[model samples]
Target: MKNLFPILLMLIIMVNASAHGGKNHEHANIFENLQGNNKAAILMVHFGTTHDDTRALTIDALNKKAQAEFPGVELREAYTARIVIKRLGERGIIKQKPQDVLAQLKKEGYTHILIQPSIIIDGVEMESLQKDVVEVQSQFKEIRIGDPLLYSPEDYEKLIDVLTKNIDSETAYIWVGHGTYDSNTAQYAMLDYMLKARGHTNCFVGTIEGYPSFDDMHQQLKASRLKKVVLVPLMFVAGEHAKNDIAEDWKNDLEKEGYSVEVKMEGLGQNPEVQDLYISHLKFKSAHRKIGIIEKKAIYEVTGEKME
Candidate 1:
């Protein structure tokens, strides 16, 4: 009976260990099953540009960086600008829209999708992208859109650090963006405010078609009394606006105001730090299925309670 007692105790211990370990093993198996079923891909959406030089420097470089950051995951690009896609098609360069690319992804049996847009602000383009994704949301198992470059306050602060790395006290810097007429244009003004608040007093921000107009920026420049001014494009690509509007129009106007102006023909995408920022956002979204309510609240606060 004594020997039987020892054997029975050993059997109980073995049974307990198996029970506990088997439960954990079963959970691990479930997690692996879910991961295995998810066939994921990233869709990089850019406003796109016809200028090959800027395209190569900005869009192409960003795409290559993203691919390197997430190896073995298929990556594709789409252009949000209909006109840019059409123009590229005319030249034997075919660029698809977000919806078209989404369809292709679905056809390829991709169940999960992460869409990252190379957009400066969450404005009209972002709204349009959201709608396009909504139309085909049922086609995919899951889809998440990463935030724009300047969505959160942290994003703005990080961008400022990237942009003001080479600030010169003697020169005034102006960041020109393609602003929209909607209230979203206020983001540019917010960036301008943040710049000065962070001791970038020599820097100013202006838009082509929105608030803080060229005159507004020029007035600030005149007040600053800085003789030299540098124009930087606050855009994904230094395309037509940076080349012509800023290089010619803003530069000439500043020159007329007795300020020696120089335009930096570089886009936001060309900055390595900016590319990494986008990748970080993608990584974050990949880990978290949806953005937090705090982020949504921030967007609403910036857009005057407008969710879209």
Candidate 2:
């Protein structure tokens, strides 16, 4: 696994920037000094959840944090899930797409646009958002995207600190996340390594769609001789995947394996530390606009898991 920031960022930005048109190397840091007529708005992009309760705790909560951090910037929301948007439409509710949201920001005379993704990994959903970004790139005066949460090694270190805060030291934790089909899925394995490196022997990360599956979790726990397992959702929202998949499905399955199971049923956004990181990612771009565009300071984690 290659954890070099420039290489990973090139991949991330190549996919993300491909949508936002070309950027000229004007000032190394475009956001260096701006005062008059240069207004910026934050577009918080998410996968979205139909469950209002989870949306309130996870997505809405995170957006509120963003608003509090950047007082003046207008914070708009966009959901990548068309199904969720469609379902909400059936109920007379309208959710905006990122492209439409960016277009509206442009019309409002917002000069600088910062797109902050609350994604855990750089997966297909993140890629989809990048594609949508292409349409409105020309409309906006200046648009830039902040990196996902897992861009730097420090991110994983902080994640281990936050995610494992409430976990009992003695009890094994099985964190379940929504996995991807691509090589990006190796992120889970890398996360697993980070957790262990932090001396978290009892905590393991698994996914519903990708590698480090429930089966892998089972075997890992058995290897550690751990019979008491706590199931936690690694999702930003504790919606269907958390409630049904981790809390219920995996819990029941693990219980059947003679392992005592407990559920946390909390979203990643609930953790203040986690929210702080997202805010930091946005803030990092304001001071370092040259990053990813020209000079990236973050280094990538070279995972043996085929980053290519």
TM-score of each: 0.84, 0.83
Question: Which pairs of residues clash in candidate 1, taking residues 3 or more apart in a chain or in different chains?
Answer: none
Error of 1 at 7 (Å): 45
What is the TM-score (0 to 1) of candidate 2? 0.83
- Highest lDDT model number: 1
Model 2 RMSD to the real structure? Answer: 8.6
Task: Kindly report which residue stretches of model 1 are placed more than 4 angstroms away from their true locations once superposed.
Answer: 1-37, 291-308
Per-residue lDDT of candidate 2, residues 1-308 (tens digit) = 45665677564654444234323211224355556888777899988888888788878988999999878768899988889899988988789888778878888888888889999887787788878877777876777787788867778887888787777777998888899878988999999988998888898989999898878877888888888888888888898889888888898888888988889888887777888988887776654443252232222232222111
Q: What TM-score does candidate 1 get on C-alpha atoms? A: 0.84
lDDT, residue 265, model 2? 82
Deviation from native of the Cα of residue 140 in model 1, angstroms: 1.0
Root mean square deviation (Cα) for candidate 1: 11.1
